[model samples]
Target: MTSADLHTALLRPAVLQILRAAGFGHARPVVIDTATDLAARYFLLLASSTAQNAFNTHNTFVPTIQDVRLALTQAGALVPQMSTAEEGLRDAVEIEGVMVPFEDLRGVQGFVTWAQGPVNKEIRRIAGFGDDANVEEIAAGLDEQEDYLTALKKKHSKTGEESRYQGTILGKDTELQTVSIIGGPAASIAEWTQQSLSTAQTATLPDADEPATPATSGISSAPLTPIESE
Candidate 1:
C-alpha cells in the first residue's frame, strides 16, 4: 500500500472514535474514509496557515497560540462573529411591516457551542483526558477550566516527545540540519522575497538630498507647456 493509504488507514480509527462519540453508532467505510481525509486536510491547512502567519509577523516559523487562533479566524473555523452593520440595519429597516431585531439575527457560534457541549466532554474522556467532574463535589457540572489534554500527555510521556516517539515517523534520533533550495539564499520563500525587495529598494534609492523622480514618464513638462499660437 502507498504511504498515504497507510496514513489514512491509521487515521480511520480515530475518526471512527470521534463519530461514535458524536452519536454515530455505525458508519460506512466510505463515509469513514471521507471524514478522515477531510479532517486531515483541514488540519494541514490550519498548520500551514499558522506557520505562514508566524513567519510573516514574527520572522519565525514556530507558531504560537495566537497564530493558530488567527489562522482559525481566517479559515472561518471560528464563526458567528458579532452582528455586522448590515444585520444592524435590519433593526431599522422594515419589510412587510416586520423589523428583525439585531439580537434575533444573531446566532450562536457553532465551534464555540460544540466545544462547550457534552459531546466534546465525552470525546475528551475517550481520549484519556481527566474527567471534568469534581469527585469532591458531586453536584458540580463539568468544569471548563481543566487542562485535560495536557494532563493526559504529561501522564503518558513526562520526559519529552523524543523519548515517547523514538525511531518513529513522528520523531527523529538526530536533529535535522537546515537545508535551502537550489540557487536560493534564504531558508523560506517569504524570507527570500523580503530579502530581494530590500536589495532592490536599496539599489534604486536616490541621493538623500535629491528629490525622487516620479514613477510615470508620460507626465512631462511638454504637457504643461502652453500653446504659443495654435
Candidate 2:
C-alpha cells in the first residue's frame, strides 16, 4: 500500500488535540504528517503481528478475535486505558464468529476497548501472566532466586558439603524467614522464639498426667539416723 493509506489511517484532529493537551504548541503540517506516518506504521505493525500470531495458533492466515487479542497484549497495546472507555467492542468485533469490519478497527477508541477487561484477562492467561502479576517482575524474581541458589551452592561446594540440606536456610513460624530473597545478606538466623514460647507456656500450665499429693499435717514424724561420736 502507498503512504497515503497509512496517512489516512490517522485521525489528524485527534492527534492534534492530544498534542495540544500534552502542552505541545502548534500541531504543524510537518509534525502531523510525521506523527501520522508513525501511527500508521504502528497500526500496521500491530496488524502484521496479530496476523502472524493467528497463523501460528491455527496454521492459517485467517485470525480469530482471540488471536488478535493475544497479539495486542503481547505488544502492550491493551494496557493503556482510553478516556472514552466505551464498551460495545465485544459485540462490534465479533458478530457470530466473523471478524469486525476493517473499517471499524480503524477507530482507535473502539479498538482499544476491544482488548480490555475480560479480553485482557484471556491475553494474560494465554501469555502466562496472572492479572495481579507483571511478567518482567516475575522474571526478575526468578532470576534473583536462581542467583541465590547458585551462590549458596558454590559456598557449599567450597566447604565440601554434598547435600544442600546440610546448608539449607532455616525458617521461622511467626515471621518471614531471615534467609535473603533479595540483594542483601544471605545468612539465616536459627529460630528460637517459637520454641521459647512453647517452653514458657508449658512451664506455666498444670500437669495433667500427674496429680498433687494432699498436704500432710504439721507433725514431724520421720525416721532419724544415729549421731556419730566425734
Candidate 3:
C-alpha cells in the first residue's frame, strides 16, 4: 500500500479496535501528513491536545516526557532516554533525520531545537523485533509523540504570532483539521447475542439421534435428551 494508504489504515476502526483490544483504553486517533519529518510534526501535535487528554484521565498517565517514551513502548516504537524536551529537540535537528518537526510545527514556529541527544532521535532502527513491528510501531510512536507535544504547548503558552505560526505548520491552509479526538473500538461484546431461525430450514437431528462422523467419533457424546424430559 502507498504511504497515504498506510496512514489511513492506521486510523481505520479495525486497527483502533485492535489497539483497545491490546489494553490501550484511551486511544484517540488523528490523521496528518506522511512526510519524512513525521516525528517532529507529531511532537507539535502532541503538545496541542494529546497532553490535555492525559492529565484529565486518572493520574495513571505518565508525565509528558516520560509519557512519550512509554507511548513508544506501548506502540512498540523506538525512543531514546532524555530528561528534557529541549535536549530531545536539539538531537532531532542534528540527526537530520526525517521526524515530525516539533519546533517548526509548534505554536512558535521559530522555537529552534536547543541541543542534540537521545531524546529527539527518529526511530531509525528497532533491532530484534521481527514482522509485527512495522505498522504498529509507527502508529504507537506517533500517537504518543503527538500527546507529548500537546502537553508541552499547553503548559508553555505562546504569543499571538507564535500561535499563528503553529497554525500554519499544522496545515491551516488546506482546511485540514490537524488533530482528531478519536476513541478506541468497543470490545468484542458479541458473545451475548442470539438470533432467531426458521426451524424447518435449520432442522438437524438431536445430538443422540445423529450418528457421529468419523472425525469426531473418538470423543464421547452427551445424552441428547434431558433425563428430566424423558
Candidate 4:
C-alpha cells in the first residue's frame, strides 16, 4: 500500500475504534478474593461512542454489578457466579474457562479491597502537588516561614528593655547628636532658664527685628547672613 493509503487506513473511524477497544479486551488475569469487594479496576477502552452505548443496549456487560460476572464470562474470563444465559452475545476466545466458586468470592473481594487502598493512596500522592509546584517555590516558602517563626520566637523571648530598645545603632547615635546640639547636658537648668529669659527680653524690643506685628505673621524679608558685630 502507498504511504498515503496506509495513513488513511490508520485514520479510519472503524480502525481507530478497534484500536481504542478495552486494553484487556474483556479478558483478565484479574484475581478477586472476596464477595464483599465491589472495587472495580479499570482498563482503557475504545474511545468510540458505539462501544460505550453498548453498555446500555447490549446484554451481559451492561455496566451493572448483576451483569458483570456474566459479561466477564462471555467476554471470556470464567466467573463461577454467572449462570449460562441461553441468548445474549457470544464471542470465541482462545482461553479455557475456569469458574471460581462462590465460596472463594470473599477471598477475591479482600484482595481487591487491599489493592484499592494502595491505588487510591498512589493517586493522592500524584495529585497532592499542584501542576505549578516546583522545588524553588517549596524552598522559598520554607525559608519565609522560618524567618517568620524566628521573629516570633525572638519577640516571645525578649521582654521589657530588650523589646523596647530594639533600634538601629546608627539611628540612636544620630538622636544623641541632635539632643547635644539642642540642649547640652552641661547647660545647667538655671543657666538655660537665664538664657531663655534674656532672649525673651530681646524679643520684646521693637527694633529687635522680631515679627513686626507680634502676631508672628509675615516674613521678615531679612537677609540670611549673620549680622555684623559692631
Shift of residue 127 alpha carbon in model 4, Å: 3.9
Ranking by lDDT: 1, 2, 3, 4
Candidate 4 ranges beyond 4 A from true positions: 1-62, 70-104, 128-230
TM-score head-to-head 2 vs 4, winner: 2
Clashing pairs in 1: none
Candidate rank order under TM-score: 1, 2, 4, 3
Give one digit per residue, the lDDT tens place, for model 3 in 120-191.
Answer: 232211222223334345546642233323444455655533565355432235454433324523222232
- Candidate 1 per-residue lDDT, tens place, 1-230, comes to 78887777667767876887788998787888889999989888999999999998899999997687778767877655443455576546566899745542223446646665665887756554456554334226355443444344456887886688677564567665555667768877778888999999999987899887767666654468667996
RMSD of each: 15.2, 22.1, 22.8, 29.7
Top TM-score prediction, candidate number? 1
Estimated TM-score for each candidate: 0.45, 0.30, 0.16, 0.19
Error of 2 at 221 (Å): 99
| Residue-level lDDT tens digits of model 2 in 1-230 | 56575346434544554465455787568988788667766887888988898888899889897677667656666554322234434344557898763232333455545644555564444333456654456556752222223444466565554443353332123435465334523233233555667789999998788897677665645656699999
Q: Report the number of backbone clashes for model 4.
A: 13
lDDT of each: 0.69, 0.57, 0.40, 0.39
Answer with 2 or 3, whichever has the higher TM-score. Answer: 2
State the RMSD for candidate 1. 15.2
